[model samples]
Target: MATFSSKTFNSALYLSFRPGYNADFYKMLYDYHMRNNGQFDTAVDVGTGTGQVACVLAEKFKHVHGVDASAIMLASAVQKPNIKYHVSNGEDLNMIPSSSVDVLTVAQALHWFDHPRLFSEVKRVLKPHGTFAAVGYSFVMLENHPRASKRVYCLGNEPDQLGTFWDNGRLIVQNLYRSIEVPLKNVERHYFPDESGSELPLMMENVTMNHFRNHIKTWSSYKNYSEKHPDRPDIVDKTVDAILEEENLKEEDEVTLIWPTVLILAENNA
Candidate 1:
């Protein structure tokens, strides 16, 4: 989390490589909220890196706020008439008025939060029966290429690689936020590509190898490893090269990348 706050962090690269939630995903979220009598007057997106989620919420909510502890990240947020950006952590949302938010979201960020404090804040700011959604995606798998997928997985799991560089919060994300307990009521968990064979439209198809490499470069673990081993050949480049060799492909060749995604939703019934 602190890696993203660093001034040296590449916010542009992060925004460019990170996939945004599609309309169907947002429709499902809004439908759940509406079915539970949730309002749409105001929404807040905590830990809103680059304001991607907030920008989408702005289209439906009358007022939307994108909050993050990183000023450098907020600087790159998309500007919209109905959206505002704030520099604050999820645990302390004192700037937002109590019981004023209709829906609160934390995308790819809930794992880094102090859960108790953040949940307390969520209850304080969300209206009665308001929605609280937490969304994140786990490891990316190369479709139809098991060897390349394993290489990508090992890059972040093998101790000699970027494994040790990741923050402890990453484990929670990898587990699909199963350990997280939202104090709100009517809690539900949904997964893309569930075990029962259900699938969501989250996969990236025909993506250039270079684009995929750039995505790996945006990882915090990769950044940490590069800083510590400045003299070593770039691990990202090496990993991409190894992947290409394993699959007999060129950088311009297109491949499919699938990310196992999770969305947990609850209502602030309290």
Candidate 2:
């Protein structure tokens, strides 16, 4: 598991800056699960960072439980009547009853988990024919501006310090979780659907350069970089300024950011 134990990592920023799954994505998951399992009573979202995905699950399921290893992140999660947040490791979810979960979801978080152990726990908690969905997001994109998009890409891929700061599990996400061993039955893989019912790129609108910077600040690699390279303190700021200057964008200018996600769905044989 990727530990967010470093003091430099801010859970609040993460919660505020990170994008949430849209209504279309949530509806698609529930529809798919019901089509196969014929029920949508309970769901468990593992590695539910700040309960973003859990909140979406709560809309369809009678009961929703979100589990995360970081207490600080859980502390800031929004509370919902049908959703209950808990501090638990993905590998061992003792808090959730065995064979009680109807569906299991890992939204943009599976890469950080111990895949084999997490899968074992999923099999244990899921009822017969239960569904497991592991979702991964690809690189962020900027619309109508290739330069700005490339800058975002460079920010993510460049900076040699990030290569070391990022956990090994990130490599799995970069590979679209294709190499992760998922021991389950009836596995299926696809891209998430947009609101238009087509598999389009996940997009967010009215974003600004400052908004992008804030989101970037929430990255684990950037946090680690700030801690280790105190001398090069202005690295993040300089990068953001350069992107804004290059794009000739004001701080409040609106831009579109798109994130493409991959979904891996499997069924519990038990």
Candidate 3:
């Protein structure tokens, strides 16, 4: 399998671990696209993980380009019609012609990008006045189940750093957007409705453990961590099994599970 670097993990990870985006999620995305563009036109889904966001872009935009550095990620996306899914690193976006896209978007994968390089490349690919949108969502343990929250935090990943460090608002700000590391001097973020419809949609919307696992598995950090610390699989499995024993497991039949997300949209000045 051809591996795409620049990302923490390769493409098979994209396919296996990434979560899905829900209908309300896509509707808001498309609505924002409409609001941003005055109409839904063409879009490029960057870091196209498992074609989850790609499928959403395809629904609204007539021309949807799904670009990734990984052949493994792109291969799975080719079957989708009216969409051009290609392999191109996020930093080196020369494969896409200048000013070709009406909107450029990413989902859970934005934090992994090299900030300066990604913002620059995004400027190059987007047409003058084109939109760049990104969003991410994760669980707030205390809201869903206090017991499971306490159990997972006490026994979950990095217990020592869990409570104060890994709290809800901070996680989304730091991990999802990389807000502090890379300030947006050239761009200003336009607010979009998250699944929760909260003023700051980045907050948790009653997410459960399975909801957390569904997407957490997609991240390269987790992949790298698990690879380095093989003990995690056992730990995660035991916790999940315990959850199953204690309460009914959240069930879904879709091959790719989706999440409600936080989206950021920015447009270059005309």
Candidate 4:
């Protein structure tokens, strides 16, 4: 979280490279929230870096609030009349009135939160039976390129590479937030690639290898590693080169990428 808050972190690049949730994902969340007669008056997006999720929620909810600790990250957020951006942490949303929000969501950021405090704030701000959703995607793999996928994994997990540079919160993200408990009722966990091996429709198709390279550069681990080893060769370029060599693909070659994503939803019964 601190890494992203840094002045030098490229929030725009991060926004461009990060995979986005599709309409189906929101449909699933909205369907779950509405299952118990949930309203769509107001929604709060905590840790809403660049307002990606908040911008989308604005189309559905009457009003939306995007809260983030990093003003730099929020600076890139899309300006929407219905969406209010707040410089606040997920654990303490004092600006929002209690028992007001109909839906609260955290996208790719629940792992960085103080779970107990965040859950308390979630309960305090959410109306009775309001919905809470947390969504995240884990390691990405190149479709039909097993060798390249393995190399990419090594780039992220090997101790000698960017692995050691990642914060402890990275593990929670890698684990797909399994360790997180919403401390609310009717909690549901959903996986993109279900046990039957059907992947979610969230796959990015026809993405260039160069795009993948830049995507790796947007990682916080990559930033930290680069800062600590300024003289060393760019590990991201090296990894991408290795993948291209092993797969016999050019930088312009397009490929499909799949991210194993997870979504957790709960209801504020209190």
Candidate 1, residue 72: how far the Cα is off, in Å: 1.0
Sequence-dependent TM-score of model 3: 0.69
* Local accuracy of candidate 1 as per-residue lDDT tens digits, 56-161: 9999999999999999888888889999899999999989999999999999999999999999999999998889998888889988999989999999889999
The segments of candidate 1 whose C-alpha lies over 4 angstroms from its true place after superposition are 201-205
**TM-score between model 1 and native:** 0.97
Our tally of clashes for model 1 stands at 0
lDDT of each: 0.90, 0.79, 0.57, 0.89
TM-score of each: 0.97, 0.92, 0.69, 0.97
Q: Which pairs in model 1 have colliding backbones? A: none
Q: Please, what are the lDDT tens digits per residue for candidate 2 over residues 1-270?
A: 344644445788888888776666666666778778447899999988788888877888899999988887887787899998888888989998899999999988888877788888999999988989888876677778888777766766775636566765777887778788789988887764355666776435457777877887877777777777888865667777887888888888878877767778888989
The residue-by-residue lDDT of candidate 4 on 1-270, one tens digit each, is 999999998999988887778887799889998897999999999999999899999999999999999998998887799999999999999999999999999999999999999999999999999999999887788989988888888889999988899866999989989888779999988887777877554545458999888888988899999999999999999999988988899999999888888888899978
RMSD of each: 1.2, 2.6, 5.9, 1.2
Residue 97 lDDT, candidate 4, scale 0-100 = 97
How much lDDT does candidate 1 score? 0.90
Residue 256 C-alpha lDDT in model 3: 23
What is the Cα-based lDDT of residue 121 in candidate 3? 83
